[model samples]
Target chain A: MKRLVQALRNVERHYLLLLAPLLVFVVAIAIYPLLFSVSISFFKYRLTDPTQTKTFLGLANYITAFQDEQVRKALANTLVFVFGTVTTELTVGLGLALLLSAETRLMQFIRSWLLMPMAIPPLVVGLVWRSLYNVDFGVIPYYLKLLGFDLGRGPLGESATAMAAVILVDLWEWSPLLMVIFLAGLKSLPSEPYEAARVDGANRWQRFIHITLPLLQPVFLVGLLLRTMQSFKVFDIIYATTAGGPGTTTTVLNYHIYTVGMTFFNMGYAAALANILLVVVAILSILYVMVLEQRQL
Target chain B: MHRKSSRLAFLALLMILALLATQCAAPPAQQPAAPAAPAGEEASQAPAAAEKPFAGTELVLASMTDQYVAAFQYLIPLFEEETGIKVTLDPLGYVDLYQKLTADFVGHTGNYDLMTVDIVWTGEYAANGYTLPLDDFMERDKDQLALDDIMPVSWTLGEWEGKHWAYPLAGYANVLNYRKDVFAEKGLEPPKTQEQLLEYAKMLNDPENDFYGIALLGAKGPAVAQDYMVFVQQHGSSILDENGKPAINTPKNVEILEFFGKLFDYAPPGATDYWWDQRETAFRSGKVAMMEGWSIARAGYENPEISSVVGKVDIALAPVAEGMEPKYGFGGWGIGINADSENAEAAWEFIKWLTSPEIQKEWIRHDGAPIRRSTLEDPELNQEYPWFPVLLESFEKGDGDYRPRIPEYSIIQDALGTTVNAYLVGEMTAQEALDQAQAQVEAALK
Candidate 1:
């Protein structure tokens, strides 16, 4: 007992003790459910079944997912959403960061105000934008009508514009996050390189391309990876606004999983689809890390 | 060392998304358990009357926040005052109510002692035994229930294979609400046939003046799916064949789909995105000259606060196919006791009292829909509502099975929900859309 107490008193042992609660919490709250999801993905489990039967199907659910046309279309939509939102947010966020990099009270206030969109829930944002996009009563179409643009079906009503409209809502909500991240990167950037470039007769644009862009590559990677993962899991906004419509144009993978799991109560299939999404996200994340690391080297 | 740390960072990121993935895939565990009436107060204020047998027994009722929830808000307090059974009301929107009550049942949490079941969910709930089969209680109390007073079609709200999984709570019939003033100005009459409806819609539509012929439920999911099913009912086409197997891709259904899509030409451009509320807004705001909707909403048009077309609206039985027999689409809510609830007796007491003819009069006065013949024919209510005759006629000829209240009903709704909207948005041809919907439903059944 004395030896055990002595071992427990060791500094490394104390550190383990400090982390034990959080470790337990993470395992219980995160790891268990994940493992449970993986297990269920191999079964045929209909949540509404009175008997609560679990028929083991091995790889059948995943196989079925590949065969399902809805799954393929949803996957395509998710990729489009991730690609559209991340690229636009990165470009616009970078521009906004550059413009507001100066230390001024007014700029500071505007920066705070810009974050208001992020603070509101995505579902609320989608609903407010849905009304604003209404062709008959919405302000957007009304203004467009005044400008003599014939909006045959409003932005959210047409398949051609539905995906883009949802992407714009995502952009409006998340761009401020990227701007904050880039602003931090900009602030931390070494001033010595800019000074050296200025002494070498580099103009503002030239200095930006040569010095700023190169240094901000790491920050860009961070922003891109974060948004890409979040965009893959988009649900609330889609649930609130389009509900995968304008003919499945806005139906992303996450929303499809929701329909399968919650609406249809087909738990096994839903879990399989979610695992597929996770794998896709994981592979993309790995590729992003490798590419960024190679560039840095 | 750098490779190890980078891998660790990658694993950390995986954990974050893994958490989200599980949350996304799994049924939610959290119950939105509203705070119940304080147990301490219930004990202190327990009624002394011997009649209050279930006094101090608290129950939770999950209800859809349809207009009728107002009646619940008004009546629940009175019930508590008399019976002393404290009932907490949790009002949820349509989709949320369905999903939440479903989670409660599947998890066997009994978070809700009672819930309002949509007519379409009768099959699924009964098949799963999520709700108590109420036939036994009905048999025991038939004398007091005045079983004869309930209209025959109202039984469709909860009856499955001769068992009552729920008791009919609110009954609605599909009816057409047209602007009488506009119809008079155009020298037209209310449409009695589907062909006439289309003709009158086109004639009245004037987009240059920001007015359209009709407002519709065109957004995807249940809104568009149920609206389409209403037309299927009106046209005397069944989503299922005579054998009760899904046959959504029939040539007749395809033609109906095409005709349904054509109505969009005369609706507001954004009508293709309108859900129930937006469609109601279009009519109430005087932007549409006509809207075919539930009889439940007819009364709201005369309430000037939400409606600009007060006293200008008149309702008729929804139009049927030119030569088909007139059978209005019937749908509404049924109050069911959760099978897992420990307070089933108290819950049944509440239902009996609420649906009684005496209280049902107060129910309609406070915006509740009617299930009883006496309540629908009440002289005073007739004077107040005035549209009850049309509703009575529609109910007498109502067809509730038009949407197929089967265990696989949600699957059918979901399939049609997507494809119908897909057809409306020109993503797929009518034949292709129905074929896809049929394929989807068949696959789900497997």
Candidate 2:
């Protein structure tokens, strides 16, 4: 017994032993749910109906997902939301990062002030925007009316503008995060390259395009990856604001999964929908990593 | 070789520890039994004798954070004092409450001793055995409960398959609320027919001036479906036929949808995006001249702090189709004991005290919707809520089953809600939308 105890103590001296708890936790919480969801995706399961046996349907659920018109629409909307929020955020974030990059007191103050929206919770942002877009008493519509914009029943009330309105909320809440990341990326860029570019008579736009942007590719990739994934899974803001309303224009894939899983209790179909989303996100992530790796090379 | 064996042993130890920890953290296999009333206790015992039965017992009630729940909070102290039982109110939003209640019931967690059930959930909850049938308890205390005093329509909401699974707490009948001042100024009486409603709406609509004829629930999901049902039922149509088959694409339903589409023109620009709160806000803010809303919102209209149309608003039965009988929308919350609850008897005691006649009379003063016939007919309550008589009349004619109390109603509502919103927004014609909804609901039912 003493020999065994001594041997166990010696084995614990390895640093990998310290990681066992974290590894076990990840397996239990993360990997287990993922595996369970994947398995359930192959069955016809309804959580609310206890009498219905969880019959194995093989790939039928996945096939049904491909044929579902609502799923298709949700996928299209998710793509639009992801592309819309990420590109706009990048452009707006890059501009703000450049503007605030200068060493000045006002810039520092403005930088700090810009982060206020980021500090606010996303759900709270949705509620604030909902109030701001209220036609009867919202401050935004009141000003737009004063400015003669003919907002014709606030922005969120019209399908033509609801998706854009939701995207703008996402931009307001998340653009600051990207801006801070880009600012750090900018500060970390070697100053010698910018000085060399200026010596060669490069213009401000030219220097930004040639030196700053190329050097910031990795940070841009990280921002794109994070924002795309998060924007695809956006349920809170849409739930708070439109609830995917005005003719399902803003019903993204995650919202569809929620309606199916929670409202309808079609657990198998919801699982199938979830796994398809996982695949889409996984592919996007892999592409981002490959591009990042190539850029590093 | 020695190191590898020790490493394997250490890994095995870690696995055993994890399993042991999980087991330790799990809930006990059996819940503690509730304290029973003393044997040989006489039926004529004083109130204090009954109070000692459940002393020191705690119960958790899962409920929605609504005006009715606020009233419950106000009345809970009286119950605690009378029974000496501690009560914890777990208030959640409507959707959150449904999700949490289902999670607790599905897992048989017994985390909640009581739950607030929507009338529409009766079939689902009872069928799944999530809630305990209150018939035995009602039978045991029928005299004290005064079950017959509850309005038939209200009490019937708790009945499914000839079993009582819950007790009615609030009876909300959807009634038409109109601006009295505006109608008087325009020399128009409240519309009694569908055609007159449209005409009145057209006359009242002045969107350029931010005044709309009506406020419509255009938000996608249950709100739109519920609003559509109010129109559909008045037009002598139902989402499901007598045989429980999808009847949404019938001619009458189509006509109702077409008329509803036109009514949108007289509503606020984003009326299609409005929910209950938005519709109420629009009416209270005087943006809309009229709206069909639940009776619960009636009290809010009388509060000057949140309403600009307090003294200007009056309630009436929802406008009906010409030659059709008036049918109001019936919906509200019912309090039910969790079947897995260890403290069900104590929970029932709380429910009984909450719904008793004397407490219900006091509850109405705190903005609780009346479910009892006695409370509805009380002269003082009628004076305070001038619309009480109209509400009682509507309740007599109201049909809670209009939305289909079947377990499949949620899926049907989802299909109908999406399609109706699509039609209203011009994404599809009425025919196309109904056809699509019919197909979706049919597939869901299958």
Candidate 3:
């Protein structure tokens, strides 16, 4: 027993040695910058200043962020985008996974084909959609005009429709990912539950409602968390399509942070805003972990 | 249990890193996939290899993907042959070029040895010392540069507070381009004043037939802001007060904003989102009766491949507000050496060679804008481009400071970009828009 324990300890030490490089990589790229961002949030710094001066202004940047109307509007916009994309993606993705989960050859081919959009870069997707949405010389507008829909300023050029248009683009690109995830969940679900439900005189609809959904709770949680996080960070789509235009209707939190950091070069305020976003994401992640832990129990 | 817990922690760490990457990894502006290779293989056959003082020095030029980029492509090979200095051209879009150059400057990367500086960036570049001041180079090369031959107004390309931060490379004058056939059919002359221009637009607008009165840039951000400033310049109103403070929300400017909005009534339904490219498209495709734009595009309107209205377009001086002095808008690119560049002399030599009067003619032929008075008056160029006379007149009376080339210009631009767009899209009234802009600019300045 003593010899076995010594061998196990040696194995564990080797495992730690292997993990050290990854840990160092993570610290350099992720943890260090995160800490730096948190530290800078309390200062007043402009990247464009020749002297690269930093004056301490503890909590002033955060206070200004709360009071700034642009920040508030961007936060609201981001929340709306997150909610819109996540819920719609989950529902549509669930439907697609169910319908396409059959093991037939055609079904497999169609499933692979549907995932094509996910393979293309989001920037390219946004640019292609932007052209399709153009008012004068675009296919969508031409067809919409024929169908008798009065599209004022087309879809992306109007304040009322811009956010919805952006959401639709995200849905087109990302719903396939959720579909694939839910499909894996569906495949792994035990057949015993459905068989028992049917044996108790449960119909297909009833079986799905009572057994499938209940069993898929963990998968739903995972999909929701993953998509909600991603939707909060939407930038490339808005940048390519609307550029937060038509009177700042589509500007999200990330894009606003970009404007501050990159455009204005107000690094301190941008860092504060980024930290706020990080905290929001962290809270969501913690809630996710707690729920996941309870489910395992 | 310990292994499982460690695995979970690792997964959590990965998630956070993924999120951080999204925030930090700013998408690098798309650069040309391949840098140009040096084409000077005949270095040994040169008049004298000893005379090539900067031979084998490599320079990278970051240029806006404007029409003049074609000129760069055409001229660089010849420059490489003559001076034995190899130049790699990196063409980028407008926003990308600005952001990339700023990042390079701020990081002191010394990535681009030379870059094309926009007129509006002069004050910012000078204030930050991002570019080497060219006054010394100009003085040393005064004999070769033909300093007096360059148009006086063109000096604004990179001049700030009596110092030259960049040498004038291309000069563009704002001029009116209208369909001659359409004007004749309507029996109307070119509008000579702002009021007459509006009246003509109203008369020419035929939306039912998929045609519009004029193509104007109404898109948010720099597009609309610059277009509105063009009208403000025409009205003889300044973006700055007499004391050189931002006076964008003045009563006179508010009236000008309303006038600008009114003109949009006759524009295309989708004009609200048109960028410079789209506006150019609308005019080139013959869907618009008139357009007020840079003289650089005038030649493109005659090219059959790109223009639908070839041989049917006419040029006129951009109309000014009635009773206002006729000061046209002048703006274009200036080539500047990066302050951190190690090959500053070689880069300056390239600039001298590119802007020489002899090469300026070839540059003009290949879609480059003219900065030299001699190039504008060259008999061959005059014969080739019939619109040179109007351009010369407009450049002589150009107002390069209309857009306010101050260090804080971008701040004002962003404010006006949002609010003017807000006003145009009916989210805010003209008064409220300008007022908000004023507040934003004031806050930023503080």
Candidate 4:
């Protein structure tokens, strides 16, 4: 105890040594900017005119963001996107993991190759898909025609199909993460339960459900939690593909904030919108953690 | 003893070389060492001349990535020789340029010494004092700027309360662009009036054949505004009334809205989504027979590299409305001085030389837009770039002087954009959407 106290005293003596770099970093990047943003959020900051008087209406900016139709649509779109992508990715990813676990060497090679999709930058993937979905020259329409489908070209960025298409891109890019987690979970599963089930003359399906899912519960929770967080923040691919276009059909919440904050320079309103986004993400994160904790209990 | 003396000599030589190296490297790190100057005792020192010679300084200028590179690498080398200043241009996309300039001004950093700002930013920027008033520069060198040279409207965007703040750099406005071959094939001359345009659009509508009569920009933000201006101006409907209230919901505007809505019947399938580049691409790819677009597309239309329909494109005056005057679309570019700049005089000289009629003619000759009135009408210059003279002639009928130049213009435009978008997407009836947007604009003003 005395030695520990001395060590603490020594650390305190060199506290500047410990804190100087961190203080410099945080103050430079995170802490100062956050305070600055919070300050600006109270004032109406216009990009073209900084000298323009900012209205100090408390909560008015929040009210504006909440009342905006575009904001409402974007929020709904964001929820749909997060829910749709996260759910579909987990199911398909777990299935692929189970299937791949059957074969060893071949599956290893295939697993490595399949992850190249994730390795590709989202922008390049979007560009590649844009070309493949082009009305004039895309491969999908050509193949569809070959298969006797008269479906015209230009399907990716039109109507509600665009929302589904961008979601599919997210699924393709991120589902590998789910597969990796499940693969680790499957490999770490104990053999005793399966042996006991075999001794009891239990079938593969019954044993699998009772054993595999329960055992992989922690991994599944982690994957879903991580993915739900990321899904709520999807912006770049959507921007590169459609620019929230065809009359704001595919505009998501993040893109809305970008256009509002950066494009229009409505700093106060944008900050309000950002705070709402932060709240949503925080709630989703806590819900995931609590749900998993409850299941554990 | 002799070997010891040789070692002593070697040590002495090494010490001298090290001292020389340290002294030589000190100036670069210690002072604003101008790269254009040779290494000397005076090289690292700031200029002493009160004439404000630009010879030993470096400036960063911002422009579009495409032809602006040519302007920097090719056109400015002679300027470097004449002025002794190193000009480095940072070229970016048009949208990127807007965002960057907006951010730079808002951040109060003013990192850019000069930037080619869009005309829309002028009024808003000037109102806020983000840009420098060009009065001092003009007064200092009255004869040099030849301030009366450029066209009046082009020059006016840079003005705030009778003070010139920015130089009118280049003029780029959309006119009616059509495929001559397509018009000939349909046995239809280019549409002379709004009703004729609708008829022509219907005649050329052949979606089954993978072609559409008319293509247009209907995307959100500035896209919808650009397309709507020609129509609204054609009907003599103003965005702001005499009392500074929203006048966009007037009967004239309603007729214009109805006319555009009817145009939807013959428009491309996803016409509501097409922006500037997409509309141009559609026309170039032979997918659309006609598009009401800008003079910026003129050079692209003539270039075989960018367009497949080269030599097949023609420009026309914007179609006239029945009850209103014919109006040409307003799209111009401008340059300005930073009010807080330390080297205001040098910046002024650059502006004057750049916008001079002699240079504008050279710019027009080399894949750049022209802003000068005389250059547009110059016989030889006109013959080379045929669109220049035609564009000037079209401007004669131009009572359509439209662009949201006020500080609240962006707010009004956003409301207008949403209204048009809602109406077109069947989200709201045309009248309802227009009324709502007008109400929104009214509230915004308050």
Q: Rate the local accuracy (lDDT) of all candidates.
A: 0.89, 0.84, 0.88, 0.70
Compose the digit string of candidate 4's lDDT tens values, residues B1-446: 54454344444433444454444532221221112212122322536464546667666677765453565556677677777766677788767877787666655555776767667677776776666677655665677666666666676547766876677776765578898998887688888888888888998889778788898766555677667766777666777788756687776677678777778668765566556666777888888888887675687787887789989989887777665555666666667755445555556557777778787777776666667777788899878777775688665443324766777767777777756765665656778767877887776555
Reference-based TM-score of each model: 0.92, 0.91, 0.91, 0.85
Give Cα distance to truth, residue B292, candidate 1, Å: 0.7
Residue ranges of candidate 1 with Cα displaced over 4 Å:
A1-17, A284-297, B1-49
Task: Report the number of the highest-lDDT candidate.
Answer: 1
Q: Give the lowest summed-lDDT range of ten residues in model 4 chain B.
A: B29-38
lDDT value for model 2: 0.84
Clashing pairs in 4: B55-B84, B174-B293, B174-B294
Task: Give the per-residue lDDT of model 2 (tens digit) for A1-297.
Answer: 666556666665554478677857865786556766887899898878846457799999999999999999999999999999999999999889998999799999999999999889888999999989987678998898898888764688677888999999999999999999899999999989889989999999999889888999899988898889788788999988888877778999999999999988898899999999999889878987887788669
Clash pairs (backbone) in predicted model 2: B218-B272
* Lowest summed lDDT window (length 10), candidate 4 chain A: A4-13
Off by over 4 Å in 4: A1-11, A42-55, A63-69, A102-106, A123-157, A201-204, A286-297, B1-52, B65-69, B398-400, B443-445
lDDT of 3 by residue, B214-298 (tens): 9998788899999999999998898899998998899999999999999988998788888999899999999999999999989
Candidate 3 retains true contacts at a fraction of: 0.39
Clashing pairs in 1: none
In TM-score terms, candidate 3 sits at 0.91
Q: Which of 1 and 2 is ahead in lDDT? A: 1
